[model samples]
Target: MSDPIVPPILPREFGVYFALLEVSALVQHGVEGQLRRDGGLSFVQFQILAILGEDPSSPRSMTDLADRLVHSRSGLTYQVDRLEQAGLVARVPSEQDERGVNVTLTPTGAAVLARVLPGHADEVREVIVDALDGADRDELTRLLRQVARHLRSRPPRSARRAPTRSAEA
Candidate 1:
């Protein structure tokens, strides 16, 4: 039997990939823990509040919020439902489109976000920014942005439909 062909990753490329994964996981864990403990919110819940807080005057559609957060539509809906129940966010039918729903941050949500942001910022600085000097941080940001842009331009593999088998023999 022939061995399957496998592409070899360059040593440097493999190291970069591993570093990115480890750093991302560690940072996310730290942030999630802080949010859960200090803010009484999950990371995703805090993210929703932050996004809504970005423009209190403007209510964002669910679809827009999902896209911005890179979340599935159904998942975003569930989060919004929970937030609504907690009085952190309110939902209203879109003025421009009756079929669409828009989410806005409530005063309570804004206050909670204001209260949590300081700790969140501190945690982020401790986990990531403070570890790097200013120049290295800027370079890292630029490089990561380039990589993100390239990745975002492509359709996600999960979004693609799989091939179907033919019925005719």
Candidate 2:
């Protein structure tokens, strides 16, 4: 419930933005070392696995993954390539769309996910969860989910139309 020491000129929304960014950066930095030590995975790679692991029986298309991650398809492809090389994920032709590719966590990927999850949970708990009381955590989660819902309702930055020149500029 306490506010971060945000600059006066930045205003309330900016304070929330900076605070969220700061917290995420810290949590990510805290786990970066552990993730490397345990799974030899980068944060994005872990995010990809974590997403796929959410429903191993279901597969996510590369385009779906790209939009979900707010990443470029090529960037995601490179990471998928690396994961593919590591035997962590498999890219199969989409049954619904032949040109589309679906990404799934392999058994090895699932095993790796299971192996790293405990430490990941512990690290997340220590860095972020432990910072708030139960009620505060609940409120935070609710507020974040609300904000996420609002944000997700909008089209992705890339999909939005760019403003056109008025010619009078």
Candidate 3:
């Protein structure tokens, strides 16, 4: 048999970081696959639906939804347009701000979410939660939250910190 191709062992500091990113991507793909094959929804689509479900009465502006999803305005518009065409959601002129538009999940969308959520929850448990024992899952949760907290404090890409002065200076 041919020798297996493997990446050179990464540095200790970066190893877990890279592995976490890879695992995150793979798990997202797995969830996406289940959504597509079983529920006919894309991951982004499901996220949008979940957000709407979170506050059905509140008018979710297109810009707000885009910001919440970290998507470009145009990309979000495209997704919302598709959802509108599918009759899953509707865009209404914002009563509070006529210049803006609000997206609302239709009854059909709500019904669909109600039907799909239980199955989706089970799939999530199977693909992620069930794979970990209780202790590990709790530890992962705590660690991930800590990482998220730290990440939120980092400066944006365009911002840079000034250099510290040396003691001699």
Candidate 4:
């Protein structure tokens, strides 16, 4: 077998990457735990509700929701199904596209979000905001925004077309 190829990563760059990974994982876990205990919602479910709650009257297409949330189509479908069962969200057939489904935040979902948002904000402040000073927060935001822009400029793996056999050869 051919040896595995490894990309060159500078020591400093690797340190930054490791720090980001650890911070993200820890923060996400904390937020997830808080959401579960306080709101009885998973992180993804809370994200879905927050997205829909942004414009309660505007129904977002499933594709839009999946893209915005960075969730797989199938995963979003399952979560939406659960939320629907709980009467927290509703799926409506899109008038613009017969094949498309639009999801909207239900009244119950909005109420839950309203109840959960204060605690969510507090958790965010505790885990992230309060940990950084103004300048540090601004610098971090700038750096992360640059990274996000670069990453998002490319098509996601699932969305990219695979190379044909002829092209590979």
Top TM-score hit: 4
lDDT for residue 54 in candidate 1, whole number 0-100: 91
Number of the predicted model whose lDDT against the real structure is largest: 4
After superposing candidate 4 on the true structure, give the runs of residues whose Cα lies further than 4 Å from its correct spot. Answer: 1-7, 156-158, 161-169
Worst lDDT 10-window in candidate 2: 4-13
Evaluate model 1: give its TM-score: 0.86
> What's the best-to-worst order under lDDT?
4, 2, 1, 3
lDDT of 2 by residue, 1-169 (tens): 8987766575777888999999889988999878888999998899899999999999999878878887777798999999999999998889999788899999999998888889999999998899899999999999999998899899874476679999998
Error of 2 at 84 (Å): 0.6
The list of candidate 1 runs beyond 4 A from truth reads: 1-5, 155-169
Q: State model 1's lDDT.
A: 0.89
Alpha-carbon RMSD of each model: 3.2, 5.8, 8.3, 3.5
lDDT of 4 by residue, 1-169 (tens): 9997776987798999999999999999999998888878999999999999999999999888887887888899999999999999999989899898899999999998998899899999999999999999999999999998898788764476667688557
lDDT of each: 0.89, 0.90, 0.81, 0.91
| Candidate 1 residue lDDT tens string, 49-69 | 999999999999887788777
Report RMSD for candidate 1: 3.2
Clashes per candidate (backbone, < 3 Å): 0, 0, 0, 0
Of 1 and 3, the candidate ranking higher by lDDT: 1
Model 2 segments beyond 4 Å from truth?
1-10, 157-169
On TM-score, who's better, 2 or 3?
Answer: 2
TM-score of each: 0.86, 0.85, 0.77, 0.88
Model 3 residue 153 lDDT?
A: 78
